[model samples]
Target: MTGQFQKSSMYMEHNPGIVENGDFRKNLDDDGRPKRTGTWMTASAHIITAVIGSGVLSLAWAIAQLGWVAGPAVLMAFSFITYFTSTLLADCYRSPDPVHGKRNYTYMDVVRANLGGRKVQLCGLAQYGNLIGVTIGYTITASISMVAVKRSNCFHKHGHHVKCRTSNNPFMIIFACIQILLSQIPNFHKLSWLSIIAAVMSFAYSSIGLGLSVAKVIAGPHARTTLTGGTVGIDVSASDKVWKTFQAIGDIAFAYAYSTVLVEIQDTLKSPPAENKAMKRATSIGIATTTVFYVLCGCVGYAAFGNDAPGNFLTGFGFYEPFWLVDLANICIAIHLIGAYQVFCQPIFGFVESQCAKRWPESKFINSEHAVNLPFHGAYCFNSFRLVWRTAYVVMTAILAMLFPFFNDFLGLLGAASFWPLTVYFPIEMYIARTKMPRFSFTWTWMKILSWACLVISLVSAAAAIQGLATDVKKYKPFQTEQ
Candidate 1:
C-alpha cells in the first residue's frame, strides 16, 4: 500500500492534475517542458489557429447565401455562443474531482462522464471525422495558396501566357511533411514564442486584408447591386434544400470543433490552482481575439462580394477592385495560413505521440533519441511516433487534397460537428455532473440554460453542415470528373 502511494505521488509530481485553488506552476523542468510564458502564448495561438483556419475565408460565401443581415447575425451569435461555452469549460476545470483534473479529462472523457458512454463515443467519432476534414482542408488551402503564388509570379514576369501547375506538384507534399516534423518537436515552451509571432502576423495580415477587401467592395461598381428574382450568379436551383441542410451542418460542426485544443491548453499550463486562472485568462483572450477577427473578416468579405462571394476569403480576391490589393492580400494570407497550420498541428502531434508510445514498447527513439520527454509517458510515445506517423499524415493529406481540392464546404461541416462536443456540449455536461453549484444562485441557472442551448445548437448546425457538404459533393463531383 505504501509503495503504491509513493508511486502515485511520483506520478502526480510528473503529471500534475487540474488547476484549482490557483496553483498554476508546472511540475517539470523548464529546459524542454512547458514554461509559464510559453504555455500562455501557445494556448492563445492554438485558439487563434483553430478559430482562423480555412473557415475564415469560406464563411463569407456561407454568409452571403443567408443574405447580408442573416449572415452577420449568425456570425455574431456564433461568437457569443463560443464565448459562453468557453467560459463554462473554465468552470468545469474548476470542479474538484479526479475526473475534473487537468490532463485527466479529454473532451471524450468529459462527454462520457456527463452525457453517457454512447454520446461520448458518438461525439468522439464525430470529432475524429471533423479533425480529418480540417486537416485535409488546411492542406488544400495550402496547396491553393502555393498554386496562386506560382501563377501570380509567372503572370508578373512573363504575362498570363505561361500556365503554372506548381500547385499540383510533389513539393507541397514534402513541405507539409516537414511542417508535421517540426511541430512534433514537443517543446511547448519554444513553440509558444513561435505562436506569439504567428499570432501577431495573423492579426496584421487579417487586419490589412480586411481593410483592403472592405475598401474595394464599398468603392467597387457592384456595391449597390441586388439579386434579381432571388437568383445569385451561382445556380442553387438544382439543390436548394440540400444546400440549406449543408449550411446548418457546417455551422454546428465548426462551432465547437475547436474544443479539443482546450485539453492541450490545460495540459501545457502550470498545474492546478495556478492552472485554473491561467486557463480562464487564456481562454478569454484567445476566444475574444478569434471572435473579433472572424467577425471582421466575415463582415468585410460579405460586404465586398455580397451574394457573389467565393467560399474562401482569399479566393474572393478576384472581386477586389484594384488587382494590386489582390496580390498583397494573397501574400499575407499565405503567410498567416502557414502559421495557422503550425499551431493546429501541435496538439495533434502531441496526442499522436502519446498514443504511439503506449502501443509500441521499444519506441525509445522518441523519448531518448529525439530529446522529447513528456510528463505522461503515453504522451511521450505519441510524440515519438511522429517520425512514422508524419509520413502517413502527409500521404493522407495529399490524397485527400487531390480528392477534395477545395475545402470550403467540407470545413464548414467539420467545424459544426467537432465544435459542439468539444466546446459547448462537453464542458457544460462535465460541470453539471461533477461540480456543486451554489444553492439558488443565478450563476447556476444561467449555466444550465447555456449548456442546453449549446447542445441544441451544436446538433442542429452539425446536421445542416453535413447535409450541405453531401449536396456539394453530389453537385460538384470534382473527384469523379478528375478520375
Candidate 2:
C-alpha cells in the first residue's frame, strides 16, 4: 500500500464508522454502537448498575452502623449530589470543540484537558489503575454469583450441604476463562439485547427483594431485645451533621459513577437537539428512578430487619415457608448480577481497546479491521492476547475480591473516591478553564459548589471506607465465611 493508502486504511480500521472528516458514516453504521431509542431506559439501567453493584447487598450493614435514619438520609443526599454532578459534567460535554469528540471524552480526557498535560497523564494512570481494580471486583462478583447459584442448586438436589469453596475446579475455571475471552470479542455490541434483558431483570429483582423483605417484616410479630451487660452499643441516635454529610457524599458519588458514560450516551443520541434533550431527560429520569428505588430499599430493609438486622440486608432472611422460594430468589439475584457484570465489564473492554490501539501500532490488532483477522493470522498471536488479557482480568478480580470481600462497602468507597474526581471535579474544572463563561453565570456557580463539595466528601468517605476495609481484612481468614 502507498503511504497515503496505508494511513487511510489505518484510520478506517481504527475509526470504524467515522469518515476521514470525522462524521459517523460507514457501510455498517449501526454495527457497534449503543442504540438511541429507549435510551432513557438504558440510561436508567446504567444508573442502577453504577449505583447498585455489590453495594446494594451490604447497604443495610453500612446503614446499621450509621443508624437507620442516617442510612436512608445519606442515600437520598448522595442521590441529589449525583444528579447535580452528572448534569454539570453533561453540560461540560456540550461545550464546543471538546478535547476528544464533543461527546466522547473519557474520565481521563476530562482531567487532562483541565489539569494540564502532566496531570492529564497522571489522572489517566490513576484512572487506569482504578479501572483495573473495578474490572477485577466485577469479575470476582460474577464468579461468586455463579458459585452461589451452583451451591444453592447442589443443596436443592442433595439433602447434604457443602461449604463454599473457591478451589481450582478445572471445568469451571475453563468455562469462566472462555466466558471472559468471549466477552473481549469486538462485536459485543451485537449482544446489546442482553443489556435490555439485564436492565429489566435488575429492576424486577430489586422490586421483588424489597417487597418480600417488607412483607415478611410487617407480617411477623415484633421481638424485644434485653440490654447487654457492661457494653454500651454505639449510638443509634441520628446526628444530622454527620448524616447529611455522609448522605451528600454518597448521593453525589453515586451519580458521579455515571459520569463515565454521560458523554457516550450523548454521542449515541440522534442529533444535537435530540442529544441535548436526551441528556436532560435521561438525567431527570435516572435520578428520579434511582432515588425511588434507593429510598424503598433502605426503608423497607430497615423496617424488616429492625434492631436485629444483619450487617448485610440481602443475606438476612428470617425464613421462607417454601425452601424453593429462597432458591428461586437467589437465582434471580444471580441473574441480576450477570446483568450488572455485563454493564461494568463493557467499559473495561473499551478502555483496553483504546490503550492497545494507542500503544501497539505494529500489532495491527489495534486496528478494527485488523482485529477481525487476528484469530487466523497466528494461533499463538490470538491465544497470547486472550490469555494475557483474560488472565490479567481474572487474577486482578480474585485478589481484590479476596482482599475486600466486603464487596458492597468497598464499592461505596470506590464510588466516593473515583467518581468525584472523574465526573464532578474534573469536568466542571475543564469547562471553566477551557471555555469562556460569564462572571456571574449560574451554571458556573452551581458547578463550582458541586465540584468542591464532591471533592471534600469523596476524600472523607474514601478514608473511612479504606479504614473499614483494612479492619475487615485483618479479621478475614481464608476458608472462613466472608463477613
Candidate 3:
C-alpha cells in the first residue's frame, strides 16, 4: 500500500488540476469529473435498497427449515460478518491510505489495486455473474408479486378454496419491459432517487409482512413450531431436512449480498470526511436496520405458519382476508424490485459501455450521445448502444425467469454463488494484502479461517440449491410456470 501511495503521489505531481482538496482547483472532482454530492444518508439508502431485496421474502421458509433456535442465530451471524467485512472493504476503496489515496472506482479496481493478477479476472467473473443472477432473480420475484396482486383479488372473490392458478410469464414480460426503460438511466450517479424510492418500498413491504405475521400469531390458531424446526419423519425426510437446512443458509447468505457493489456505491460519495468513513458508517447503519427487519419478519412469520410457512408471505398466499392490504404489499414489492433491477444492472451497463468505448474509440454508434429536449423535462442524452444492449439484457433475463421461475431455489443459488467469493473471500484477501499482515499472525489466521468456513457453507448451499432447482425443473415445463 505504501509503495502504491508513492506511485499515486508521483502521478498526481504530473497532473495539475486533478488533486484532492486543492484550493486553486475548479468546481470539479479529484478525478476531473463532475462533483459528487452523495452523503452518508444517500449511501445508506443505496445499501438498504440492495440489502433488503427478494431474499427477505424467503426468510420465513428459511426459518422453517432451520427451526427457531438456529434461524435467528444464523441471521445475526451473517449480519455481523457482512458488516465486519464491509468495513474492511470500505477502507480499500482508496489504496495505500484509505483517506487520501487514489480511488478504486469499482470492485474489480479494488481487487486489481490490492491483489492483482489472475485474481482480478476471477473477481470480475464472480461479480458480474452474480449481478446477472441477481437481476434474473429480481425479475422472477417482481413477476410473482405482480401475479400475487391479481391472485389475492381472485382468492377474495372466489374464496381461498378455488384453484385460482395464474401464470407468471405475462407478468415477467411486464417487468422486463419496465426494466428496459429504467436501465437507460445512464449510471449510479443518477440512481439515488430510484434507490431512495426502492428503499422506501422495501420498508413498506417488510413492515406489512411483519405486521400481518404478528396479526396471524395473535389470531389464536397458531401453527406448530419447534426449536429444531421441521420434524424429521413427519415434516420432512432425513435427507430432505439436510438439503433444506443448507438451502436456508444460502437464503440468509443471499440476503446480505450488497458487498459486490459496495465500492460502486462508495464511488458516489463526496469526500471531506473521507469516502471510506462515510461508507463504513452507512454499511453499519444499513446492516443494523436490515437485521432488525429480518429478525422480525423471519421469526414472526415462522411463529405464524411454523413448519408449513410459505416461501413468500405475501406472494405465496400466506394471508387471504384483508385482500386489499395484501394487494398493496405485493404492489410495494413489485415497485421495489423495479428500482432494484436498475440499481444492480447499472454497474453492468457502465462496465460494458466503458469497455466498448475503449475498444472502439472512433465508433460513433457506441461513443456518441445525442441530446434531446423533452416537453417538460430538460435535455436527455440518448445513446443507441445503451438502449439496444440494455434492452437485450432485460429481455434475456425475463425469458430465463419465465423458463424456471422457482423463487426460493433461484435466490439460494445466487446467494450461494456470490456469498463466498464476492462477499467473503475476495474482501478478506484484499484486506489482508492491503494491510500486509504477517501470514502467521493471530488476526490473519482468524480471517483466513473465517473465509474458508464461509467457503464450505457456500459449497453446501450451492449443492442443495442445484438439487432443488433440478427437482423443480423436472416437475414443470419451460415458459409455463403457474403460481
Report per-prediction Cα RMSD to one decimal: 7.2, 6.4, 5.9
- Model 3, span 33-87: residue lDDT tens: 6568898999999999999995687799999999889999999999999999999
Candidate 1 residue-wise lDDT, 241-311, digit = tens: 34553463355236434666565556566544455566667777877777677677766776777666666
lDDT of each: 0.57, 0.54, 0.86
How much lDDT does candidate 2 score? 0.54
Best candidate per lDDT, number? 3
The TM-scores of all predictions, comma-separated, are 0.75, 0.75, 0.93
Kindly list the per-residue Cα lDDT of model 2 for residues 20-86, writing each as its tens digit: 3433443222323333444555555555655565445545434444454556666777677667666
The residue ranges of model 2 lying beyond 4 angstroms of the native Cα positions read 1-38, 66-69, 94-105, 111-116, 146-175, 185-191, 223-256, 316-321, 368-396, 399-413, 438-447, 481-483
Candidate 3 overall Cα lDDT vs. reference? 0.86
| lDDT for position 270 in model 2 | 47
Worst 10 residues of 2 by lDDT: 223-232
Identify the candidate with maximal TM-score: 3
Name the runs in model 1 displaced over 4 angstroms: 1-42, 94-105, 109-123, 154-171, 187-189, 225-257, 271-273, 319-325, 359-367, 370-385, 406-410, 436-483
Name the better of 2 and 3 by TM-score. 3
